[model samples]
Target chain A: MIQLLANPQRFMDFSKWAAPIFGILAVALLGTGFTLAFAVPEGVEGSGGSGDAIRFLFFHPQLATMSMAIYAAMAASAFFGFVFRHLLADAGARAAAPLGAGFTFLALATGSLWGVKTWGTWWIWDAKLTAELVLFLLYLGYMALLAAIDDETKATRAANILAMVGVINLPIIYFSVYWWNSIHQGSSMGGNHLGPDYVAPFILNMLGFAALFCALWIVRVRAEVWRRKAGALAVQAAGKS
Target chain B: MSGLGVLFRRELALAWGRGGGPMLALPFYACVATLLPLAIGADTGPLKAIATGSSWLALALTSLLSLERLFERDFEDGALDLLALGDEPLEAVCFIKCLVQWLATGAPLALAAPIAAMALGASPGLTPLIIATALLGGLGFSFTGGIGAALSIGSRRGGVLIAVIVLPLFAPPVIFGAGAISQAAAGLDWRAGFALLGGYSLFFTALGPFFMAAACRNALS
Candidate 1:
């Protein structure tokens, strides 16, 4: 699979059809998930669940998972780019960052809203929440590095290194935050044990969001490939002139 | 090894003489300490509660003050290229630079942390723990902050960019260090936080050079 996509032209061709299929899957699964989620009678999710706020379970957990998953994907691509000197991997890393950031932001927002309904506050210093906030900042830092460097090749290399470093640090950050939170106070929020009915829709929504992310990532990587080609062509034309 | 030693000494001199040495960082640390009471009002109750954390915050920011020019000055003057081509690996060179950065800036800031904490109404009894944690945490900051400094070498908005990149990386140490101090003040077992702080510093010290070296190479290329 890596060998097949090593060529930009081949990857572009593959993604042309693949993106649309993923998009269709996303729409169908998300539609079904949402319909089923809403069809459940209000205040009847899991035992001791937070009423209608439990509906957020459908969207928030999936978004939160995708947010972390995308960072992993981004760092993996960055590792490939840094190690093998693959430009496509670099492009993939760049393409995934903003989408990851968006998912992270949505996760935070939706989670905060859920908190408001259940915890009676807009925010708490929960370890998971703090780690998610750090992840969002990490995304912003990545995007900023990409924007600040004038040379595209250099930017890719620099940002790739940063991504790899973040991957190494992320677990440590989570652990530290968890430890810090534990020492400060006991978390009032208990874990939600999902019932059998909530599981299918939750899985469906997660798959839908993953599909949507994959589709968008394909499209963005394709765009990045085109942008690089154009940039090279412009440089060539300038040199000739 | 000898090459690294020489380079280390050279970087130490430059870091001290060029940037006003500890003077710059100390004043900045002092100002942050001074500002906390002023900004939050002179109530010792609230100030004491935040004292250790605020000192850690100041140390982190003060470490950042000197990082922007960590590699940029060398890169601009072509010293980085020379070092990259020398008998020493770029990794060692980066390690030396960050060590000097810690010794010149972070070390002094670490020493000042207790004073700042005390000024903010932190109990005088917490001073030793505050100093120890700050020193280890400073080591972590220098090495980790070096990665950010190296990454932003040729980029625009370098100062602010380094802060953005480094501060998130700084979070773990700050939490561990401040947690240790606060835990001690509360008459609780502080060993876990202190051990974690040491582990964080050691981990970064071991691994940060590779990242910094790679970033420096990226900028050089």
Candidate 2:
């Protein structure tokens, strides 16, 4: 499938239709997910019952998952771009970073709100929270490197290397933070702590967020493709003049 | 092999002469140790408690001081091109550069680590462990930091960009290094943190060169 869409024109054609479909799907799923989650009465999903604050589960986890999923996808695309010399792969990697960062930020923000509701604190240096924050920093670093270089190709190449390094280091960073957290003994929200009733809406919102991400990623990649093509044409025209 | 030795020595000399040896980083380390207590209030109770951890934090930040010039100088002077075209692989050159980086800068910083920690009111008995962890952790820093330096070789914003790129990578070492010292200070088994720190440094030392070389080639290209 990647080979079929390796050509920029094919990607452009595919995304033109695919993007809208995904966007519509995202809206429909998110709409349904939110309605279902809110319909569940306060105090129904947990022992201590966070009331309406339980709705954050539908949003926060999905955004956090998307944030991580996008980084993995971005790194994979970067690897292909660096190794196979695919321009579209590079463009895809570049387009995904800001979106990933946005998702990560939302995840952190929502997680913080959830904390305030349940844990009575706005922040704690929990293992998962620290790891998410580090992931956000990684995204920022990737974007900064991409923006700092003047030459587009060099920037892409450098950022690709950084992405690869970040991916390799991600697990180590997570483990280290977890180890440190163990010594400090922070409370973590375990999977078993939540009621099974919350699973359905959570899955729905996760799917919705994934679809939304796909739509945005395609649009950004298309924009980059067009921008590069326009630049090429302008340079050619100047040479003739 | 002889070429690598020469490269190692040459990097050491360049680091010492051009970058002011460890003069820049040591003072920065001391200043951080000094300023941290002042900022947090000089109460002996709190300062004594955070002594080792804060010193580890300072070490991490101090390592960032000389990284901006790690590859940028060779790159700007056209020497990186020569190194790339040399008979030896660029990966080996990167390894040697990072090794020399540790020797010239990281080692001295490690030596200064215990002093800074002691000044911060860490127990004096923790001094040897502090220096040991700092030495190992600094190796990890130098190697991992070499990747950031190489990646930011031709970047417009060198220093801050390097910090933003590299600081997250510094987390593991800082955790392990500080954790080890704190474990020892509390008289728990410190071996686990020390072993983890060693493993982290070894892992980076083994793999960091390939990434650094790749980044350098990308910048050079």
Candidate 3:
């Protein structure tokens, strides 16, 4: 299947339309999700305006989950690149870094805001929050490493190794943080604690956020592919001259 | 493994050479430990209470400082290519290099951890545990950090990049090591933390080489 897309022309043709379809779907889904999320009856109890904000506050975790999912996706793509030595996988992995970082940041920021409202602090070294921050840094490091290298293949290969190594640590980080959280004195925020009425919008925003991620990922990969093509063309023209 | 002993000795020697040895991290750690007292107000009681934990943290951060040079300096000076070409597999070479780093960086940090802890006002009773945990945890940091250093070889900025990649990966060891030190200080059963630290150290040293070797290969290519 990857071989079929190996041809740049075919990839361009397929993604040209597919990318836009996903993008439009992403915007529409997000729009509807947010609208539905805000439409819910305001307030958790006595917090008044905060209740409405807190109602959709679960989106923070959804964004975080998507962020990690993006990193996992990025790692898997890079792993394929490592195993198969395919350029598309390289492009896909490279393209996902910024998007992953963005989601991770949003997750943290939203979580922080939620914390200020709920926990009365902007930040806490709670295991979940800390782990998400680390993951965000990982994304930043991946992108920084990619940009720092002038050699394209070398950059991609090094980043692939980092991503793969990072993926191995992901489960460890998650479990360790899980254990750490259990040991700590946290006023634990479990998913089930939220009202049953809020579950619908929570799940909706989850899918909507995921759709937005996929849409951005597809478009980003296409852009990287085109950039590489342009670079190759310039090199070719220089050689001819 | 043909020249394993020779390679180890040479690495140890090179690690000790002027401007490259373990001394760099010692002073940096001291600086970090020094700042804590000032930051928290130098009340000896609080300082003593937090000393062991802060010392362990200082060890982790200092090892990180030393780790950025694990592969980068060698790669830059062309020593990495020669090592890669040698009879030893790159994986084994990476293992040995990280071992050397552990010896140079981790060993001293461990040795100093006792004094550092005491200086920060920790009781003498917990000194042994602090030393032991630092030794094991430093190896974990060294090995895991070796991967980050190797990965950053072809990249321009490495110090911060290595920290970014390595710190999250360092959490387990940090928790286990610091846990052991603090538990020992508190006169609780600390053996579990020690066991976890040992597990983390062994795990990272065993698997870190593969990624380190792979990253070095990519950087070389």
Q: State each model's CA lDDT, in order.
A: 0.91, 0.91, 0.83
Model 2 CA lDDT for position A21: 98
Using Cα atoms, each model's DockQ against the true complex is 0.89, 0.89, 0.68
Across B68-115, the per-residue lDDT of candidate 1 in tens digits comes to 889999999999999999989999999989999999988888778888
Put down candidate 3 lDDT per residue, A110-224, tens digits, no spaces. 8887777776789988888878988997898788888878898999988998899889888777766765565446635544455665677777778888878888888888888
Task: Check candidate 3 and list the clashing pairs.
Answer: A43-A51, A44-A51
Task: Tell me the lDDT of candidate 2.
Answer: 0.91
DockQ versus reference, model 3: 0.68
- How many Å off is the CA of A151 in candidate 3? 1.1
Off by over 4 Å in 2: A44-49, A190-197
Number of the top-ranking candidate, with lDDT as the measure? 1
Q: Measured by TM-score, how close is model 3 to the native structure?
A: 0.93
Model 2 scores a TM of 0.97
Please write out the lDDT profile of model 3 over residues B142-203, one tens digit for every residue: 99999889888867777988887787788878877777777777667889779978987898
Question: What's the candidate order when arranged by decreasing DockQ?
Answer: 2, 1, 3
